[model samples]
Target: MMKKIVPGILTVFFLLISLQKVQAWGFWAHQRINRIAVFTLPPEMLVLYKKNIEFLTEHAVDPDKRRYAVEGEAPRHYIDIDHYGENPFNVVPELWSDAVQKFTEDTLQAYGIVPWHISRSYSWLVSAFREGDVDAILKLSADIGHYIADGNVPLHTTENYNGQLTGQKGIHGLWESRLPEVFGEGYDYLVGKAQYLDDILDEAWSGVREAHYALDSVFNFEKILTEQIGSDQKYSFENRNGRLVKTFSKAFCTSYHDMLDGQVERRARISILRVGSVWYSAWIDAGQPNLKELIKKVKKGKKGAENKDEKIEEEKENNGHKLKIIDRESSDLLGMRDVHEMLFGECEGHGMGVGHGHGRPNKPHTQTAQGQKEGLWPLRMRDL
Candidate 1:
């Protein structure tokens, strides 16, 4: 009788563990922007674009509670040397870790490859339109907005991530999340229609390298100004909860402005404008024609809603390898494997996708409220 009850209890225990992983889709505002931008899909391919949009919107945030916004926060320094044992980069593949294919695949799998992830997302966007429809091009152009915006962020790429070694631990929060949150609205929003970007990987890497290299100045300037920045002047009044919140004061802002010489805000403005331009360019690539007519063309060319669900049935049957986890939903695309290799890289075998890593034990385990709710002891998530 005791043994019979054991299986039931275990079953209930595990299901609840995975519940925490499921929550709001994205933590980054950019991801939220990407969610809304999908609507810009050309009318002809609107339905397909929506499908892809939903995919990205679903898994925009981290599933792990410990690092819910891991990527959202850049690393201030490389991991402690002791953590990696000896000669760190040897074991952990970073920047150029995997072969170009695998590396790119990994990038697409994770958070930092914002531009490529956005690009691959667009492939599904392009597929939604008619083969020859010009109007479909305009919509694709509009979708480029998000990827282009990604290119502007220096933190979007590189190793010395969030000023950890540089001693500015919260710098990631200040620049990427907070600054943008505060001043984004004042920036220019127009960049004009996008133009074709030649050799997208090179462009993306260049963007990464530029942002990565910029870390030097980002840290240096802050350090140099630290002495002059008084606690009171550096922290002042910002309205919050119907009361003023003490925060970066006008003095700090003035010093930051002096150091940047207008570059910080300029880059933000450029990012905003270029996002709009790239969106326009991708549309041009699809051949700027007419929206409604192209919509009819796609409806006739591809299997619309009638055959849509069936397209992914086979991918589902075979080990879940063909499923692309966008936003969080598993989009079972027919040629995801081929395109996955062509655009991103050679994907790992089944179970190697982002956050779904194999053999991880600490992933929250299903526990009844009466079970190990307070804390998990010696048995790790892997053991569980």
Candidate 2:
């Protein structure tokens, strides 16, 4: 009885591990997207975003947490486009009302409403900005970024989200979670400034449409590589956070990444740009309230805001690697001094012309609720 029970327990443990792995974009990727999107905002919005950059970055994964803990949360993370028909783009209306009119709200919700949720999140953000509710603005901003990022992921747009349908049970995690974890650090993230979005709902739908189109390649490439490489070479066990766990081998990930030929990176970049633009647009629509004043008020009321230098200094002391944490205050001062002398330009109170620091330090700069080191930032915050 003991022997039989032990084997069953081991099987359940492995199964739970696999289920957990399939969560959205891995936690690190979601946080990285939110952190980078901050840099893309213009000075008006940047002033506001940079003040609460930590909040925005840290809370980016809240929606994922809520999916498990809150009712009606899972639908916001994905949409099974193929469920609608051959051309989901043509069949599905862009507007929320039109969509509900064509297909009842229950039907839409049953399928998933990620694209619509993106638009709803945008509106909520705009309201938060207009009201100047610092907490609401931060929470909604982080949440919207998550939905938009989810919309950008090809797997999130498919019915075979976890790939249980096509004998590719783990492909969802492999594509969105694993590929990015292994190869993402080296990809180019120099996405340009955020432009104002004219139609938020249309933009959301466009993202979903584009992601749906990429689904075939995401599935086919992995399946092809699996058949070629065989299982032994494709998987290996390694220590992660002090636990021995099985995962796709580096060689397998590299081969699959190569076969995709930059789809993952392309989608990530697009997601970053879209997230930034949508945030900026919401601020503008809300009459461009003074985020600076609000932040100042919040800071005064809340004691013990982490000192920027202390955090960086602590990181510098403990980090084993050579990578340095770019000093935000000094970097801004230097960037402004250079800009003023070179261009004879006046620097804004916010560091607009100043350059971005390199992406998050080599070591984790923050901790998760679980007390584990959260990952680094993906893009440098602009000096502005």
Candidate 3:
């Protein structure tokens, strides 16, 4: 009785752990992508991003979290482009308006809208930069980094995302989560500096097309490898976060990683470069504002709030220039609602289930109760 109960308990625990990790690119990868992208920024923008690096890194998973909290948030993380047909890129229009006209907004939303959402997020980031809203800029930067990372993920571009249809269930987590968490330390992330993108939408589609092109290898190699290594040797139990969890054996992971010929590393590097380029492009479009000045203004405002009696020091630091101090609390009020409303025009229904093919059942779409807008900012400056 004791033996049977222990095994059952362990099974439940492992399943829970696996479920938590099956999101797009996994939280660890997402944060790493965003953190590394910061280093790729030019000095002009680095001054601000460096100071708030932690905020950017930690908030990289905000969009994933919103899938469970905000209405219509899941679709922004992925696109099942394979649903469109053999030549999905050419079959589906690149522009959001054009695609909507061809497929209807409801039809497109039913599958996924990651590429279009990337463009929308990019525009919002440009707006945030132009407005010099530190909070919004940070928030949108982190959020856009996530969508861009997702766009580069091969799994995010397919309807069979998790391998459910092809009997390769759990492949999503194995490829995106387990492989990266295990071998990512050795990856060379010095992906050089970010360049400004002339056309954001074209860049976004380019990534999707490249990722989609690799889909056959992502699936075929795994299938071939699995046939070579029997189930007994394919998986093993290991301690993760202090608990024994069953996962793809290290040998199997190594085989698959080698079989892919550095595909995971390539995608991750691309994500970093693309994230930085998108950010730099947004800054350029925003009239090349001095990010260093934004940092100084934020610090001055924070200092003034802390020492109200030091009006003389504040004035002297201002150097006769009027400092347009942003109210920290008020500025921080911006959340996903603004982005959702900006792109989709409504934020009413709960989002679909975890769209990265985590094998979870679709979450029922229902109306969320009012007044639950807390924890929505992608980057919370207060914590910074």
Best by TM-score: 3
Per-residue lDDT tens digits of candidate 1, residues 147-188? 544455565444445677666665555566555455545545
Q: Which residue pairs in candidate 2 collide?
A: 351-384, 352-384
Of 1 and 2, the candidate ranking higher by TM-score: 2
Per-residue lDDT of 1-384 in model 3, one digit per residue for the tens? 456545654665565455456654489999999999999988999888998999999889877766644557778888999999988888999989999999999999989999888888888888889888898899889989999999999999999999999999999999899999889999999999999999999999999999999999999999999999989999999885699978899999999999999999999999999999999999999999988888789889878886754323122233334333334454333432232232323322112232331344533322223212321223322211
Which 10-residue span in candidate 1 carries the lowest summed lDDT? 73-82
- The 10 consecutive residues of candidate 3 with the worst lDDT sum are 367-376
| Steric overlap count per candidate | 36, 2, 0
Compute the lDDT for candidate 1: 0.44
Using Cα atoms with residue i matched to residue i, what is each candidate's TM-score against the true structure? Answer: 0.49, 0.72, 0.76
Winner on lDDT between 1 and 3 is: 3
Candidate 1 similarity to native, TM-score: 0.49
For residues 279-326, write the lDDT of model 2, one tens digit per residue.
Answer: 999998999888778777778755443353433633443454333454
Regions of model 3 farther than 4 Å from truth = 1-25, 306-384
- The candidates, ranked best first by lDDT, are 3, 2, 1
